[model samples]
Target: MLTYVCFLVIISVSGGNAAIHSLMYTYLATSGIEDVPEFMTVGFLDGVPLVYYDSNIYRVIPRQKWMNMAVESDYWDKETQISIRFQELYKININTAKERFNQTEGVHTYQVMYGCEWDDETNDTNGFHQEGFDGVDLLSLDLKEMRFISLVPEGIPTQNKWNNDSAWLENLRFYFSDLCIGWLKKYLQYGWSSLKKTVSPQVFLLQKDPSSPVTCQATGFYPIGVTITWLKNGQNHHKDVVLGELLPNEDGTFQKSSTLTVAPYELKKNNYSCVVEHQSKTFTEHLTEDEIRAIHENYLPNSTIVGVVAAVLLLVIICCTAYMVYQKKIESESCSDTTRRPKETNPSVLFLGETMLLAF
Candidate 1:
């Protein structure tokens, strides 16, 4: 299994009146590994991990708040059983793969990623199923031909066997065309409130010193779609620019970075800026004294300071709100029966309504 995996979300989700969304699951089985799980799986929706299960965990666990709905609805139990089946199946698959490679003992992996993508705008759907051994493709599904195709020479026999099974072919057809799409749509419906919301990125420019590269970082973005580029003189980008991968934040938002490498002499003569495009908004940060932040003195950036202050303020507000509610509750208890307080409405239900997935 890859160490820093975000799952193989084959299709990137695009935004519009009706955007493209994808649901993918990756199953990985490792051979002769003591520190890691023997089998694991991750499920992604629109490039975000919604659920995960490892041999050690032994049960499916929800990763997002919206995913808790599955637990409340008892879907997680069914999923856990399915994952257990895959855990056993993939172990055998990995052993077969090792035998095919003529290896007796070693650390290796057998991986599979399968999913379906739907364009809500056009009502079009696409499905994919790919398997790999030791990070190289071994077999892939060919939907048009209704068969599994071998990607490597060793996979030919397995591909032929899978293709010759008429019942398996029919099941595959129904799964990709109907079952997968139905499940994807149902998940979308269940989590649309959280998935549809978008948060603008907070951009920052950081540098260690004058000779160091200037990194323009954008954080707190949602939807997992963003572009970061360096511009020179408001037009083309600087000669040396490195774009980083999109990563998830602890708060479920996303972050990305673009770095500009230039000499100090070049910095004074030309104007370089970092431009970030997310959703329908554009943010630009220039390389200047006011924009650049220094970390040599162990000082935090303005963004970090602001975030800390905001968090404190939010805590204060929540405390005040709770205190006020407590006061009101006391008044009610004095005026009416104390037992009635227990029957009062839950604050979470009142505020979150049906949006609350699970609190405990």
Candidate 2:
């Protein structure tokens, strides 16, 4: 078997709320003197054009733009040469995405990921690629056969015969397994290192409404394997506990929350606590009856507050407008009365005319 060094890179983009998630992979061989790095990218999104890129460029270039520019500009030739060489690879990515994401229709969540791998040895190279939904692998590739493969949660039928070819077998033996194994080892090493590094969690207890469950939220923790439990009077209360998934934070840490439901009487009578376990450390937080009552008393529901504020502002605006209108009406009435009232009779002028007539 020929020994080789290989590198694999995977990029994934995912979306939420009826959006499609995309996964792409590229492989490179670095062992032989003539080895050249190979690259590819694929994206799955509704109404978005297909995406593919090789070593010639780092950013994503749309297929339509590449095609149109290929004939118009000299730079197109250089930029598209690698793409032309990897046309089959691009097609595989597209087909795999279509099969996996159902043409990206009715998708609610999507993700984008980047992965790289390197091997040392005959200079053979392999790329291990996969795409999925909801943590389930949907499609992958058989690098040796240069064919698409289906994964769990949804399976596509395959009639590919190249796997049986002796040449394909030879390539698989020399390149594929070694590259995958090397990548897996690297991944495990990184994961182990991450687990060793820990950050304390910031925990809070909040209740939005009296009818809703009280939530114990823990955020900014590392390694993602943490548990939150509700305790009543020093005893675990599993019946009223609801655990949430570990969600990633913007800083590469994780957050999770657990909720506890209790009757109004129970809440008043019993002391409730939130207990957290992570990386061999345990944390306990007790919620006093007074504290719980304070949360309810001090907190005004956002929706209610918003509605009340909006209504009050609207009322003030309406009252001001009505006052202005009434003032204008009063002013107009006063002016009209002044204009309509008959002028007082000029008694001095009448007497002066009578006296002048008598003198004449």
Candidate 3:
């Protein structure tokens, strides 16, 4: 009974398509093959090889020999040994105990194979090998020049898993589904980070002219394998972008930058941001309308300061004039008093009525 259970487990594991596809991809990658195939609905495409998954770069290869060398140099599945054959070659039985390869000229093309399967001991040597289709030709591909393209796994979601106790299978399904989704999300994030580093070193923005719009500028680098953009409110800006030079770094990495003319209106408000796209991630430096205003906030005009000082001086003059007017009024009153002849009658008044006064 134990042996029978083990047999059933083996069959079940082998029959899982998802598990099988994962193993197949890993096996081919380690086989030192130059051309990495892209998975599609029908099969896989080997013409355009995947070079960097993070950058999503792929190159096309025309020949099969380069692919073979790449496979042999890399570590492949120890238990799996793949076979290949050209077109018009003889075919083998599908049910043969050992796994075999099939060569065809369909949309999905196989460049290499490596792996093994369970089979009978007596007929192990007579196992079926890979067979090919007719008129499928090989090209002389150069490994170095091949372009690399990024391929994203299909149907992968980015979400957390749910739990339900109504059915045991529901819980199992949620676990597996969420696991794949989480993996894909993390994988993409890591790839983007790596890609950003490879694209450029440093970038910045500056004012083109005091009167003109704010311009994005860079000192240490040129744009390559990356995009430079100016944004307003999370939208792409469609203005002329000025590109800078690619400067050398001590660490052997390249540096580049770009500049854009912020519209006069936008600059007035100071609502703008510069975005650098390397790989799938974006690095953004932003200035809000308030921020831009603040940059020049302290720079008051000389004329304005002078005007303010003049107004203050005028206020002081008015106050002084008022005080002068009050003093003049007091001085006029004092002068009038001094000029008035003391009533002239003080001494002479006695003599006037003397005759009548003598009788008294």
Give the number of the best model, judged by lDDT. Answer: 1
For each candidate in the order shown, give its overall lDDT on alpha carbons: 0.61, 0.40, 0.26
Per-residue C-alpha lDDT of model 1 across residues 1-360, encoded as one tens digit per residue: 332232213315622233788777666677776776787766666765667677887887776787666335655665676567666767777788888888859777776666778888889987777677776567778877878778778798887776776644554555567656766777787777767778899888888887888888888777667888887787877478887655555455666788888998888898988888988589988888545744334433443332321222222222222111000000111122323322222111111122111110
* lDDT per residue (tens digit) for residues 35-137 in model 3: 4222110001110111111101221221112333323332122101111111111122111101222322222221111111222223221101111111111
Residues 1-360 of candidate 2: C-alpha lDDT, one tens digit per residue: 001100101111111111222122222111111222233333211111223344445534443232332223343343354334444343454345445557544322111122223332333333343333323443454555555455443445321332234333343333333323343333333333333456777776777666567878777766556889888898888987888644444343556789888776788788889998877477887876656557656553322222221222222222222111000000111122333422222111111121111100
Ranking by lDDT: 1, 2, 3
Please list the residue runs of candidate 1 whose C-alpha ends up more than 4 Å from where it truly belongs after superposition. Answer: 1-11, 14-18, 31-38, 70-72, 102-107, 289-291, 294-360
Give the true-structure RMSD of model 1: 15.7
Model 2 weakest 10-residue run by lDDT: 324-333
lDDT of 1 at 210: 77
- Return the top candidate by TM-score: 1
Q: Which portions of model 2 miss their true places by more than 4 Å?
A: 1-105, 108-176, 180-195, 292-360
